[model samples]
Target: MAILMFISRVISLFLMVVLIFYKRKEPALLMAWLLLLVFLPPIGCVMYLLFERTPLPRKAGLFLNDIKDERRGRQASVSLNDKITSLVHFNENYNSSRLYLYQDFMYFADGKSKYQQLFKDIEGAKQSIHLQYFIIREDEVGRQLVQLLTEKAAQGVEVRLIFDSAGCFGTRLKYFASLMEAGGQVYQFHPPTFRLIGLNYNYRNHRKIVVIDGRIGYLGGMNIGNEYMSLDPKFSPWRDAHLRLVGDAVWELQHRFLKDYYMVCDHQEDERYIKDHLNHYFASPLSTTLCPMQIVSDGPDTTTDDIKLTFVKMIQSAVHTIQIQTPYFIPDSLFLETLKIAAYSGVKVEVMIPTIADHHYVYRTTTSFIKELREANIDVYFYKGFLHSKIIIIDEELCTIGSTNIDQRSFKINYEINAFIYDKTLTRQAVHQFQLDLENCLLVDDSYEQNKSAWIRFEEKVYRLVSMLL
Candidate 1:
């Protein structure tokens, strides 16, 4: 046993040295890994081996180049406001995302309404339907969606789907057998050769996107599950945010979905065909409304944390107020500092988090940040129910809504997407929804952290030590 302990320490030291050299760019993450190795040598080394290696193809840029067309003309004219010009330029340069002028936008705060419109749109697909999700459970809601896709496929509309293997671990392929038999093409993102065990286990495609007939698109926080519809007693009255969009932005959504599909799908000939006929997958914009937004995406393949930087830019741009809602709040040092700096600069920073936890360790880590935020004069709200909305409204002129959470995993690890809307009308609507949500929350004050139980406080401290992994 002593010899085994010595060998473990030696191995841990070797990994620390290797990680320091390989991960010099990410100092914070490197430090976390090093600390983990020091504290729990054997288990930490195993985790580093399992999770650090990415299974994603390295030629992500080549795949992106295939989908883009410099020869194509812009479908909608866009004029950016001066206030958001820098933000727009940053997303454009970093993410290769163009500002799209969308004509229509609809926000859904519940699953019932979002699914109603989504199902209707799927039912109305004329040419094709592309759907991507992190999770598609083998439940009532999931079957209903599959049934709709199967019916659509049988009717001759092209149906395609890409689901993350890790996210749908328990869901059997037989569940989607009917859809596939009906001519629908389904692909799993980075499926392990053995069930639920692989190097790609840590990296997940957490994006939720649906593009129907290349005209309408749907994206945001809610996944396909009976729990999202509040059928599960554990998380009753689920609150989440989703968007239904029509105009040039839908084309961008289609592009993003196709990019993910290209990575997961093995048919090279089909990819070449899709690349050749891009216009068939992207319908011409008909709306003339002047709503400008950028669809930005980030993941492990990307060098920089584009979405996190985007969030920082949004936070820094705030001159009046910053209101944010997220289910998880384990933000890294930079993000936390930005919020504190914004609050210090006299911006009214308000953050709302759910009271119930879907993951215990993550929930505790989230609570650990409350004292720091409260001490910095930032207002924290404990939402009554499951608040799964990933939204941030700044200065009532700009807002971002999508799958991104204020956590390390969403910022740097998972494949995520968000829409940075630079329109006041929509921002105001989001702000209004946030204000309404405040009604069902308890505003944390000085005494809230002071009143924590010793055990709870200790758990929070311990969990926060490894918050980066969470």
Candidate 2:
């Protein structure tokens, strides 16, 4: 046993040296792992082994390359404001997200309205329906969604669904047996290989997207659950944001869904199937409204942090005002610095977060940044109820809404998506809604941190030390 202990110490030291060299660029992440190793060597080594980064399957890359080759020169050029032109160009070059003119943009601040419209669209589906969510509980809402998709599949409409295994941990594959029996396809995103070992557990697919009939698309924060509708007493009055987009933008969403589908779908199936259905999946729609939008996505499969960089660009372009709402606020150093710079430049910067705690360590880590953020002259507001919306509005002319939090997890670990809208009308609508939410918020002034109990402050410090892993 003494020899075994010595060997473990040697291995841990070796791992730490290797990590310091390999992850030198990510200082915060590297520090978090180093702290973990110092305290618990065995557990930290096992975690590092399980969660180490690896590129996406080679077959997935080949599939995306073929699709990219076919999609070249398909995007239409559009005139954009000088301030946002660089931001748009960055997303196009790095994320390969094309711009589209959406005819209709409907924003939902409540889950009831969003799910009602989503179900209606599903009922009206004629050809295909693609739905993806990070969580799908075994509750009334989840069952209803499965039933609806089963009915659509029974009606000869192609129905495809993807859910993250880690997010829906207790959910079994049998939960989707009925949908599969009805001829609908359901795939779990990166399930565990062994009963106790899940290689992709740390990297989750956090995107919530829906595409119906190649014409309508939805993407945002609300997942499929009764809690999202405020039916759960623990998290009553749940607040979130979702977007229902109609027009050519839906084609971009459809393309994104197909890419994820191809990643998990059987590669043994004839590749000709995707080629044959390309036109059907990307049918163009004629619309009059010119609402410029870009559907941007990022994941751990690539090295580029596209969404985080896009957020940085958006904050940098701010001239008059910036408002951000997110449940989690454990941002990286760069993100925190950008917001501080914006405030220093006289941009009215405001951020709203929830007063409640869903995850104890994560919530504590979020509060840990409050003192630093407040010192930078940024106003911080704690919503009276649970605030789950991931939104950022700039100058009442541009806004982003989707399933991305202001944290390292969303920026680097999870598969996330967001819609960057560059329309004055839609952006102002978002700003107006944000103002309404602010009425129920409690501002954190100079004395807010002084009143905190010693225990609470200590918890924050402990959590903040390893926040990057959260």
Number of clashing residue pairs in every model?
A: 0, 0
Q: Give the TM-score of candidate 1.
A: 0.94
Candidate 2 overall Cα lDDT vs. reference? 0.84
Model 2 lDDT-worst window of ten: 53-62
Q: Can you give the lDDT of residue 190 in candidate 1?
A: 78
Residue-level lDDT of model 1, residues 200-287, one tens digit each, is: 6678899999998878998899999998998998887689999999888887788788778877777778766776666768777767
Model 1 poorest 10 in a row by lDDT:
53-62
RMSD of each: 2.4, 2.3
- lDDT for model 1, please: 0.86
lDDT on C-alpha atoms for all candidate structures: 0.86, 0.84
Model 1: pairs clashing at backbone N, Cα or C within 3 Å: none
Model 1 stretches with alpha carbons more than 4 Å out: 1-7, 25-28, 53-56, 59-67, 71-79, 193-198
